[model samples]
Target: MYALENEGGIKKVKKLDQFLQDNLNDLRDRGLYNEIDPVEGPNGPVIKISGKELINLSSNNYLGLATNDHLKEIAKHAIDQYGVGAGAVRTINGTMDLHVKLEEKLAEFKGTEAAIAYQSGFNCNMAAISGVMDKNDAILSDELNHASIIDGIRLSKAKVIRYNHSDMDDLRAKAKEAAESGLYNKVMVITDGVFSMDGDLAELPEIVEIAKEFNLITYVDDAHGSGVMGKGAGTVKHFGLSKEIDFQIGTLSKAIGVVGGYVAGSKDLIDWLKVRSRPFLFSTALPPGDTAAITAAVQMIMDSTELHDQLWENGRYLKEGLLKLGFDIGKSETPITPCIIGEEKLTQQFSKRLREEGVYAKSIVFPTVPQGTGRVRNMPMATHTKEMLDQALAVYEKVGKELSIIN
Candidate 1:
């Protein structure tokens, strides 16, 4: 409890502000306070903020399509034709032609029989999980699955069993146990196509085999993998398991470079989701501009692999540069790189120092990861040039050595 200040013999402490301030101070003291740095313009490889330009490595704009001129033009055209808002929910009159086109394009892109669009990737997870799984079901999820997945599982009211991250044996054993228990009317296995934090890929082939052995539904949330994997189709296609997986979830926001999400699966599955998913039934639909832009972006991705190649090349360059500088760049199979720093405060400080030195990488600390394994995650994009990466590397070395994180 906080006491009133002596100077305010008149009881000067405002109760609401005092409570919030106290809580905020506690977060700061614990080194868990998040510092927001807003970008002034587009989320390109280099971003400007507060009159300073930085080599940005903190965005999910993996393909640089977020700022692509072509996508912008397409979006403007959509707005001209259909306006900004969708005008209603999907279950109502909001199923615009662009929305239908986007879903069709997504189905074709993902090689699924049909697809249904949602307002966001997070919404897709929430809707897809709850719409399919219920109290009679059990979900076997990866321990490192995204927050959206965890929330979706909770919303589903299904029994959630978290197996070890990327551990095939653990998953196999869990699936077997869950199947044998016979407590569930249906069992589903959900996982991220690519784990966002470590940038490691999920073992989809092994998971698919286990799912088949146990007669489980397989769902892949390829939010981070779209436009960055399988030459831009996604991780399911990357593993050549497109036909086998039951559900493929993706986002238009990430590599697609716009907004909204979708679930691509059998026509029956999508029809079920469209009717039963809460977001589609209750929430407003995705706007015409976003729907059209996403459709265009997916087409661009399916059309060529130039952006994909450049993204991987940039990832390799950043990793190699960090490794040569004696930074503990973790074993990331993708462009999502993390420089591990042990302590929470130190990791936050390292991120702050990087920003001060013209780089913008954010810190990922407890309990997002293990309490002690704090890190600064760097996401290199296809738009970044070699010179920009070189600049970022130099800044990293400076800050890392300043904090005694690297020799």
Candidate 2:
């Protein structure tokens, strides 16, 4: 026990105190300490942070619809009609018409027979995997799969065999072994549609081919690809394999610029999830406003590819700019540009200087990524004006040169 003078002889357990203090101190010393910046007002390409206006490259607001006027009006109208809360879990009076509409819209947007919604993209993965998998099942997962998928696989009590990231040969060999082993009743192959860290796409066509060859159930968590690919349908549609893939998970929070997640697939699969998915059965449904807002946003994406095209154009522009400046922007096939700075402390310092220079991109290091592969992941949006990007590039060049990240 340790006594604090200010506590007037109250004794605190030293062991518990030491554990938290030691971990926190170690995190700070290792440049792994994450200081959360509070953004004032709505999230857009540019945002106000601590009263300073910065070009925001950190948010997941891809299509700039987080502050869209149409979505705002729709959300307001839905709140006016349905109030704020969902009142209870989806199985208990929480399944409102708005939820039904959102699911239907998601199914249509994803070109699937049916769809199911959850509280978040993470919850969607947790629910979908465990709902269909169990102790006797086996999952052949990608090494670079999202954290949510990893957790869900772990929860299902399934044997997880991780294949190399986007390595089709490794996938084929593992799928063959898992299929022939006779050790499990079912086998599934799961991958992220887009790898968030490197901004690379999953080899979905090859993955689908392997799934069919091995008679494996295919699951893709398209959290980063929903509104950014195939005119906003998803990676499945992007590859024209909508009917081939089994479980297609997505988030309304990223490209859709809203909050929530979903799984779109065959009617039987979705129906089964509706009944067995813990989040859908036990957690409260999405707020009425979010449900309606997501539906409207999906419909807008379906109506045209205007926003999608803009997003790509900006992505290309930013990538080209960063490359020309000689920053080690990694091989990203999407808008997620990672300026790889190999040292942990310099990476954090670079992000800090960028913030001071009126850019708000955050530094990513450690367990989120690897130790030496530290980088600043920039997410440019559809709403970024050319002038804004030019300013950002100038700031980037200045800081990049100062840190010797570029000559």
Q: Which candidate leads the pack in TM-score?
A: 2
- lDDT by residue (tens digit), candidate 2, 61-90: 999999999999999999999999899999
How many clashes (backbone atoms < 3 Å, residues ≥3 apart in a chain or on different chains) does model 1 have? Answer: 0
TM-score of 2: 0.97
Give lDDT: candidate 2, residue 89: 96
Residue runs of model 1 more than 4 Å from their true location after superposition: 1-19
**Candidate 1 lDDT tens digits, 159-226:** 99999999999999999999999899999999999988889999999999999999999999999999
Considering only N, C-alpha and C atoms within 3 Å, which residue pairs clash in candidate 1?
none
